[model samples]
Target: MAKTVVITGGVSGMGLSASKLFLSKGWNVMIADFNKELGEKVYKELSSKYSKKQVAFQQTDVSNATSVTDLKTKTSQLFGKVDSVINNAGIFTKGALHEVAEDAWDRIMAIDVKSVYLMTKAFVPDMIEQKAGTIVNTASISGLTGDYNMAAYNAAKGALVNLVRAMALDYGKYGIRVNNINPGPTMTPMFKANPQSVIDTFKKASPLGKLAEPDDIARVMYFLASDESNPITGENIPVSAGFEIYSGQPVQK
Candidate 1:
């Protein structure tokens, strides 16, 4: 039987790209997202390409335990055992520490960090029963280093990076793996909303001199989910195109 995977935020951006990649690899996929319209649309689109039996969509609010549980239940019904769960649903916010709005802080933490906990709670038990599974998170370079005006996002992703580490330790004994893919500035809808100057700066900072496409991150997500990375867990693999390698010094011509 083909392996089954659940991908949150699987309607758009990197999540959508990853869903397609997994389908192409002949995996049974359940795409979970908060947007019902987009979810149904993507479900139809993918169903046209692959068999309906191999693809499904569940409208989910990942931060909410009840919704997450429903997602797990439906996915299980559709695909049987989930071989992997990709926590790719996330929201981004920008502001200095004190300038950050209380609601923004709470919302970002709830979506980016708490959702992972809820997901693990909902799925890991079944994984443990099966004695095999993988969990992949969509983290960011900001989690590893500070950003000028992104305090809340940094803190949330930072928590996620460490969460992956802690969960790996807790779950690895059961033959489950936990890891995150930390991508630099990617040209997702969120990045495209930034000022052009800000986008240009990110381009210049990367040695590759360009932003990552959604597919770029999706490929790494696939690697982490596959048996190819069985020995790797509790790790944050950077798909940043060398954006983090700079020392912040101006190069002398």
Candidate 2:
């Protein structure tokens, strides 16, 4: 029997690429996103390309406990036992500490951080019972390092890095692996929304002279979910084109 995976935010960007990758690899994919229209559209598109039974979609608000529970129940009904869960749904916020709105901070924290807690709670029990599972989180380089005028996003992602570590320690004995992928300025719709100067600056800063594509990030997600990385857990691996490796020093001619 083929394995099954649940991917939040699976309608677009990196999540959409991951959904495609898993389906191509013969895994049953549950595409969960907040946009019902897009979810159904992508569901139809994917169903046309692959086995209709191999793909499913659910309109989910990952930040809410009730919505997440509903997603878990739906996945169980549609796919039986989930072999993997990808916590890839998140919103980005940017502002100085004092400039950040209270509601904005609350929303970011709830979506980026609390969603992980809710997902683990909802899915890990069946994983524990089966004695195996994989959990992949779509974090950012901001989680591992600080950025100017992005206090809320940085804090939320930073919390996720440590949370993955704590979860690995708690769940390692149960033969489950938990990891986060800290992508560096990928060419997703979210990143492309920035001004051209902003995009150029990020690309120039990267040693490879380009930002990552969604497929680039999705490939690493696939690695963490595959048996080749069975011993890897609690890793905040960056798929950024050596963007985080450069020091702020000026390039000498």
Candidate 3:
């Protein structure tokens, strides 16, 4: 029998890549994302290529507890049980601390931090009951270090990093494993959404000549989700391609 996995924000970017990888690995993937149309399209694309039993999608807004609950219920109905979850739904905010709007900060926190809490709350019980599961959260390098004009995103991701550790400790005895991946300058939609000047500055700051692709992040997520990492838990693994170790330095002109 195929393992069942639920992925939040699986419609695009890193989540989408992870969904594809899991499907390739013979897991039944239940994708949850806010964009109903895109989610449906991706589901169709995957289902057309694979068996319908291997992939599905549920429209979800992870920031809403009700929606997350519905996602959990629907996923269980679609696929008997969920063996793993990827809490990858997140939003980014960039601005000077004083200039950042309160609503923007709240939105970022709600999606990046609160969503993890909600999803874990909704789905972890099943894992605990079954005495086996894995959780992979998408944090950011900003959470480990810091960067200018990313106060809210940094703070929320940092909170998520610690949350993963606490959950790992709390659930380890139940055979549940929790971990986080901190990606740096990934070439996702969020990265491209930044101002060109901001993007240029970030490009110059990284030791690597290019930003990471979504696959780079997704591959690490795959490892953490699989039994291959059965012994690993509570780890804040960095997928930054040496960017995490670089000191601030201007790119050579």
lDDT of each: 0.93, 0.93, 0.90
Worst 10 residues of 1 by lDDT: 241-250
Candidate 3 residue pairs that clash: none
List the candidate 3 regions with Cα displacement exceeding 4 Å.
Answer: 189-204, 249-253
- Across 48-110, the per-residue lDDT of candidate 3 in tens digits comes to 998887899899989998999899888888898889999999888889889899999999989
Question: Each candidate: RMSD to true structure?
Answer: 1.5, 1.3, 2.5
* Candidate 2 whole-model C-alpha lDDT, 0 to 1: 0.93
lDDT of 1 by residue, 128-188 (tens): 9999999999999989888899999999999998989999999999999999999988888
RMSD of candidate 2 to the truth, in angstroms, is 1.3
Best by TM-score: 2
State how far residue 70 of model 3 sits from its true place (Å). 0.8
**What is the full ranking by TM-score, best candidate first?**
2, 1, 3
**Model 2: worst 10 consecutive residues (lDDT sum):** 242-251
